[model samples]
Target: MQSTLYPKCVLRGLATTTAIAAIAWATPGLAQESEDPPAAGDQVAANPNAIIVTARRRSETLQNTPVAITAIQPAALEAKGTLDIGDLQGTAPNLLITQQPTGSATANISIRGIAFADVEKSFDPAVGIYVDGVYIGTSTGQYLDFFDIESIEVLRGPQGTLFGRNTIAGVISIRRTKPTMEFGAKVETTVGSFGTWGMRGVLNVPIIEGELGVKFFEFHQQTDGYMRDGFTGQRLNSSNSENFGLAVRYNPSATFDATLTLERQDQTSKPYFASAMVPGDAFCGFVPPGACGGNLTDDLYTAYKVAEHSGFYKADGVTLDMEVGLGAVTVNSITSYRDSDESFYADFGTAGLFIAQRPQTYEQFSQELRFAGDLFGGFDYVAGLYYFESDYELDQSTFVFGAPAGGIGVIGHSESYAAFLDFNWEVFQDVRLSGGGRYTKDKKEYEFPLILSDSVKKSWSKFTPKLTIDWRPTPDMMLYGTWSRGYRSGGFSGRAGTPFSAQTPYDPETVDSFELGAKTEWLNGRGTFNVAGFYTDYKNIQQSTVITADNAQGNETIVVNAAGAKIKGVEADMSFEPLDGLNFSAAVGYTDSKFNGFIIGQPITRPDATIFLQQLDYSDVDPIFAPKWTLSLNGSYTIPVGEADVTLSAGYRYLAEYDQQIAPDPALYGALLAQDFSATPFVVPQNDPRVRSDAQNLLDASISAQVPMNDSGAMANFSLFVRNLLDDRGPSFAFAVAAYPNLWHYGVPREPRFWGASAGFEF
Candidate 1:
């Protein structure tokens, strides 16, 4: 018993390094080549300490991963001033994250023309978020700060294999920096125009040698608004956000490691003001109070004010992981727990003449265990068991002529349990066969005693499977194909209408997807490209319907499922360092999504209330919000200046406009684009609304210099960043009301040319 652990620790370290060396010998080309003959001039190998990710759960170079993944390293993100998830848009193609016109704690994320589209409490996101191996369930949970991150991986396509629930579209994986047996700290601060100020810092401290370590990170950002609220006389789009986190790591023995993390984010903001949805022509004339007449336009903007929102998101979790090498097999044990809460108010004008407030909160806990290793016959596999439980509650307080709506509340709860297994076999020197499956049993309970008499509970079970074949014809090229299954659990509607609200439950959405992809690296690793094509068959799709209620008089509406849909798309990404000191990256995506065998004349909610003559025509056309073309381009150049380095980066993004309505009446195609800000009328097709495009290009650039500190391995850096350096307002307002046929703004009025200089030291 005389300290036998010391000898075992030393032996294990030697064994691990030795095994890694042996693997390198067999592959000879894995990750070590960059260590020696680094790539060409002014080019550096990707951070040597970077944790390689396959996205598909395999171990491969980020540049060589077969799937179409865009990884933004922490340093790269910091360089680009991306402090939160919403800023990830310009860096990736076919990806957009925008806060609702009224708040910050919640954001709408779209990828390849697929998105959640609704911010309702029961809504599930099309893009799944995974942080530190834990799947955060909702879109509201996706608005956290980008603190102390190692990398953010955006995998485009249905990731139904390893990541299950809500991954029918794609997966976003965030890996945070882990505690190390060292002491280090970095701090930065920036001040810019428009009363904007920001600061962030990260620190890692070793409490004991090989025994305990702790890492801490925090950030604070505040900015003034660009618009003024007419009613309150306050800045309309002001914001303030604060985030802090602590992580503690304990290494009890040579093979045991455990970590505990506590994190919180406080965000408060007032968002863009909006007006009521208006119709065209004399549509609202049929009603006594016609639409878009007299004070309607002025009163609509005044009446439709979304109250300021305050959000508090706290996450406290612990993970216990142990890795033991048992000759040819390695045993890995991971246990985790997480809890999250989100509360926000959504204001709808028609529901409340003044303002309506809807508050929602979600609580969740999750745990899972995995075992992975290599055995005989070139078989590598990982098997796991998973379970999750969550509770969601919605409280509605409506104000019509300044009063509450009976103080009603709706509550819902969900419980999910699953088991999954994934394995891969090296069928040949150049080929591998992989397969995985997940069986999930989910149960949900909904209770609206204040709105309904009886409670409702529904249970669903699904067996999702994935099959993939990967072939590496050459070490620099990988070709793969995958077929998988996807699912989205059903929930109750909170609307006050009939039939739909009477059912108490809806059907789950399911999809079957097939995909093929290829990744290739050429020009001596200076250039890499990825391409993928996918087709998905969706069933039991959910659509929001407006049903008139018997008791609520045209005000109460219910949401329901309409029919199925089909989606097909092709995506490509390329990164090329054509010459020394310059790097170019581009991403292009195309989506063809539409309804299949859907009937016409289905009644739905229209933005304009008074316009009555229009008929919805569902002919051959693309689905709403599904754009046919999306593209992004970025380039960076690094130049050596004396003893220091200078870097320059620029980026551009574009999206093709698509249709918002599917009216069957041919007359609607000639409807005018009578935005309130415009004096002229422009006619466009029903599906091509001419809204998503400004027909002009956007440009952003930055320049930075690095100055080294003394011999202590620290440094002071200076950087000046500018957005919209050309002073061209990107896209401003883009909608019109039937009552006010001539008022419109193209898009969000972006800030003008603003520049900031920052100086920081890292140790």
Candidate 2:
């Protein structure tokens, strides 16, 4: 059942009241400390809320920026022992990050109930990921591991003006630490549960004092996995990865600077085990009754698979970033190129009745140039141009009952160009008017060599605009309202089951969003509270679903403009330091999303063996992955133990239940009824329980101590941490294969409890 744990009206009221109180209780003389905070690893600033950010392409205080964004510092990330992007799942509001089963390196991210999860390169991700000013074009490599990181920012809502295409939901920007022009070295090693162990090293060298510097870093890790294979009694979800990178910084003069980076990563892992959830299925009939059931068993870490497979991923990339300061104006350029290749096999039936393998290669190149300046004493503006191109080739083969069922090969190419201009004017003494517009053009070409003799091409263009009005009635508080639009490109389905579906093309999707927000610092910057309420009109959603087809392949995945939805949500984040060395923070997100229109294609077979689609209305179906309420609470305390500082931290996160599929296919149900399948007795519900993941509660804790090695600013640190403390083994993803007599259910479970300890040194 769809869960509405928190009422929408109550959440909205709470958000509004919080914002109003923050403005009303503003104190005087508390806003003069607007200087940027010191860099990471430096001394702590007096006011914790004075952190600087570049969310608008210009340097500004977080409290002064009108956008709703969360900036996570390196220290916070380290406290929780964060490894990859997926580890930040519950750190922000209205955010969800899950590693897909296809590959451990692939991430499925959703913000404000907007997301797209697919291995196909033709489908664009709803949320945009940017690393070091370069956009990551594919989900295959989006789950980046953390090494020498500076900051991570999660921006909620549409970032249309600055970030052009595929940003209909929002953007995640990650910045890596740069060379400091001084000699330094650091090393760390970790050992943890599931036979996990890793080591990392970083070195910095100054080629010329204050002129040029270089930094090198490497990381490697391996884990024995948690899930046990029933056939071989060996681990099925093991992983091993290695990453190395180098950065060179050249600052010949104060007016101009440039930094170049090169990186490579290699990884190997066994895909997640697909646990079957039915007893009468063909494959399940061969297994014991204890292994085949209608629901997940207590021993969720065991998979009854008959075969094992391993997958590998390799990636290489390079980036160049340059900035020129001209007194009143600044010019910046960013150029990047990245490529990756991966191959993985998946057993959809866990029992090995149906198996598939996909091998893909992807490459992308992008260049961006932007200029920022003050046109007048009270006017600030930024203009930019962007160009991006990407290409990918995918080969997929399937095996049914240990027999080859042919395969399909797809090649896709995409090119995009955009121009944008954003401006802010100080209309009044304490009020500002800001507006921006971005014009983008995207062209896509796709080819299916095994199915189609000719390639297909499509083009889409959109002009997204933003308008905002902000008032800073008091120096300690700011209130703003904004309206914006976001767009995502469309293309042909690469995993189409039939030739007709392969040749068909889908249209682009868009969203219109309205938001009101407030940012405030109270009690002399000892406390901070921010709140935002938004309503988004999501249109032409690119919904992907699995359906039975009348082709050689019984089932195929298709993408369509399935539905339009109305999504309304409220988000609030607060942090307070009530004591000298203690801090507490909380983030709450409430989303009320409903589909206004839903249309699905139902397969129908004619007497002549021809297959066609009959449009059906499924407007009552719930949206997938749209959790009603998400909450996170965290606390940390620090104590000065002689010359060393000992700190302890803990966090708790809660996620309400959410659906994984739109609705069961009516045609599949009818076919099962005709066959008199006994499973029909359990599948007669309008809202299938098999397609929903229940609510989850997660707990994590860590303790660490830092000691001064000497007066020369060297430090030694040791830490211990645990995640999923309660060992909640809930399914992160679930699905139903409702193809006639092949009816069955399968799901991927979340990782179990993990405990680890680490030690590090820096000099």
Candidate 3:
């Protein structure tokens, strides 16, 4: 079949091109004008027009920034149908942003090879996500709805020196549409499969004509999940979410600008159904929601025994930014605060008797002051100082063996401070050299109420640096090489499999990276091409260790900093206009990542607190979700249909397979079972689907037309779109927790074929 051949062909072709992926996944969603060609929809806008960015914390053209960054304009975002942040997965090379297996309103954002799925109260994600210059404090609510967005920038590789904090791997920066003086409004709605319905609206008002303006946006979407329950006939993994935001912009004078934004999101959803290796119960109302994940019914069946209250997540935030330009120098200030709460209950067995619930709260506040200008006649410089504080709390609860063994609450707080400097020296006209450095210090404290002597405190410090050399051979072409270092803070974790009292803080992580790349333009701005090669020296890799619960059935989470690791990759992007009304774009990324040393752990300890074996050596594991290859191709053609102009676009993306978790082989799992229970000779299922998923292909297409209403410039359009045209459902994430008689494989399922139609008008 074509589906089978597609995977095989793409796997073989990945190496033939010797090309890897881009940083920060950015899906192209906006509608592009026929006159301009676009870049890879998976990579960026793909438009032939030049893009402006602030990847280095300074405004400049993307091609002139000398970084492996992709810019997604509003047009590309619309074209790609990226309504949510996680929907942008595969838009960037080597980027994987998937739903957290636990439940809704969470994300696992990875860049290159660094990633984390630890749900502990203190573990930091290697990839940092930012909205309007404000850092998202935790992974709890990073999956945001995209309503009125201006652009999104994805920076690949380590960006610590300039971006700071958890950006050891990369950064995803989102810029929302600011208020404009001109009045405007747009409303869109969609209906699709599985009882899906969506509505979105935006309004722009000129409160004071040219000096002051306000913009407002809101979005709501819901679906009746793809999976059905075998017992109660209930749905699983369904979602209902709403998001809204308001922004005000003030431009009092020519050189001064200020903006304020407020936003809120509320999401409610059911948990992913668990597939059991050993079926325990298959009846509805057999057990409460606190305990699940034991009974096996069907691959897509979910057992719902209790009242439906699975997941609830809410987030609110506010930001203020001010900028002043004085001749050749500019000063900027950013202040923001965000709060989020996540509460969820998920079934483990098809019978719905064995379930788990988690409640978490997160709050963060930050401030940054920056200055940029030309110095020493030939040097451009940017310097900044930043401060951040946050509080996080989580409770993991479960009903195991007819007992309440959960309700263990963990709370954590942290404060971070940093100072940074960056400079670009144009020493020889065409040859420019840039360097930057950041010094950061972080302090943390944690308290686990259920565990004795659980109050913990620690601190971390690091200095990251970056240097780059760029050669602009022509006005449209540049070649650059960069060497840089990145850092991620370390803190106490409560999710480890070990006893809460035995868990310790993991060490901080760091990475040294080197990149060589070229950016070029041809055919008089009709075509553009860029490629890059990178190597990373990764150290103190933080891995989540799985261990048998001393007195329970499922495995527990432990955070450990394994030895080290290495990653190398290459990527290329091309976009061009071959004919009038026709545009084609392609981008690909290939990565090679592996652990450097061993991960030794204390051997099997029983609920009686007695050791049964010595520490074992575990090493050379693959990076989680670090796919080996990522490829994207897209094309669009325009045609005149009566009095309206019509455009048809199609795109395809392939994501290579990678490990979903640090899972164990069947034999190793048996050994762990022996330590906890007297079960010997236990072997895990070899064909369990929860272990991982193979590489998969995704296809999407859209058709839209713009019909000019009158000479007054009013416009209206309609669109028909299909995402996942082939209906490929490969696991986006998988988890195999040792659940006594069965090693349960539960996860967030891949999206199935979804089609929708929409129409909107702008006035």
TM-score of each: 0.80, 0.90, 0.87
Deviation (Å) of 126 in candidate 2: 0.4
Give the candidate number with the greatest lDDT.
2
Candidate 1, which segments miss by more than 4 Å at Cα?
1-51, 101-104, 230-234, 252-254, 279-354, 401-408, 495-504, 545-559, 599-624, 658-697, 725-755
Report lDDT (Cα) of residue 13, candidate 1.
35
> Could you give candidate 1's per-residue lDDT for residues 265-362 as a string of tens digits?
66666544333223442222321232223232223233223455344344444444444333334344444444444444533322223344555556
Per-model CA lDDT versus the true structure:
0.60, 0.79, 0.72
lDDT of 3 at 713: 72
Q: Which candidate do you rate higher for TM-score, 2 or 3?
A: 2
Model 3 has an lDDT value of 0.72
Model 2 lDDT tens row, 1-763: 1212124323433443344334323421222222222222131254554778788888777788899898876787787777888877777898888877776488888899998887678889999999988899877789888867888888999998998889889999999888877899888888999899999888999999888999998999889988777667777678899999899998765655678899999999877565556644435666545457645534456776666777999988878787665555567778777778889887764577667898888878787878888899789999998988888888889887778987778888888999999999999998999989999999998888888889999999999999999999887899999999999998999888678889899999999999999999888988889999999999999988777676556777888896699999999998889988899989999999887667665564433445554554556666777788888999999999999999999999888888776546433545434443232132323335666777879999999999999999999989999988998877776777643334456777787889999899898
Per candidate, the number of residue pairs that clash is 20, 0, 40
